[model samples]
Target: MNDTVKRKLNIALRINWFCYVGLLLLFVVRNLLLEGGSIQLWVIQTVPLLLVLPGLIKQRYRSYLWLCFILLLYITTSVVGVMMPTRGWEDGVMVALSLILFFSAMMSSRWHRMQ
Candidate 1:
């Protein structure tokens, strides 16, 4: 890839990382505040994301692809949360972050292979 494509890939990767971390934090905080700090809930929500961490840190295209799939689960749950009568802003934020993460990861992986 040329410099511009490389630059774009880096930006997408950075956005992917940022959104990934944001979703992680959101899950942690949401569990703590709404689930009485339930360890089980935290583990269930975060373990999949954590599983991809090693590959993600290595900037592996396969990891990014897997992340896109993993994020779909989050988006589904967040959409349900949004539809609930007692939903809060966090649900909306979660949906936004997950979507951003999914797209960025997808694009990052595509760009990675272009090199």
Candidate 2:
């Protein structure tokens, strides 16, 4: 890839990681702090991302593509949460952040494959 694309991909990759990790942490912390949630519940919230983290850390295009698929699940969940009567601003924030992660992951993977 050209320098510009490479830089863009790197930036996107970083943003994807930030959003994914931040959301994961937020889920865990929010549940534990607010609800005294169980570790099992936290694991359930986090295990999906654990499956993809290694590949993502390695900057694999295939991983990025798969992550886009994974992000769809989160996006759907966030939208549903936002629509629910009990949902908060946090749910809306998650929806926005996940969309950013999805876009960044898609673009990063596409750019990586193009190179």
Candidate 3:
């Protein structure tokens, strides 16, 4: 990639990383605080994300692909949450953050590979 495009890709990757973290935080808050779930339960629920975090921090395209699949699950969960009566807004936040992460990762992968 050219200098400018590589820079842009880096920016996108950073956004993707931050959004991923944000979504994870949302999950923790929703499950542990809002729903009164136990820490062990929350850790079990979010463990898969931890597997991908290192690769994502290293800006690996493979991790982005894996994250896309994970984000789909999150999207579905958010949609179901939105359908619920009380938790709709929280789910909406998840939906938006997941989408942002999804697009950022997707674009970063594409552009980075074009190098």
The most accurate candidate by TM-score is 1
Specify the poorest-scoring 10-residue window by lDDT in model 2.
28-37
**How many Å off is the CA of 94 in candidate 3?**
0.6
Candidate 2, superposed: residue stretches over 4 Å from native:
none
TM-score of each: 0.94, 0.90, 0.85
Residue-wise C-alpha lDDT for candidate 2, range 6-94, written one tens digit per residue: 89887887898789888887787767776656888778878887888899888789998898898899899999999999997678888
Residues 12-105 of candidate 3 have per-residue lDDT tens digits of 9779868877877877887788756688867875887788888887777888888888888878878887888877567789889988888888
lDDT of 1 at 17: 79
**Ten contiguous residues minimizing lDDT sum, candidate 3:** 36-45
- Clash pairs detected, candidate 2: none
Candidate 1 residue lDDT tens string, 1-115: 6999899998998898789899889888888767555878889999999999999999899999999889889999999999999988899999999999999899999999998
lDDT, each prediction = 0.90, 0.85, 0.81
**Cα RMSD (Å) per model?**
1.3, 1.4, 1.8
Candidate 1 lands at a TM-score of: 0.94
CA error at residue 13 for candidate 3, angstroms: 1.4
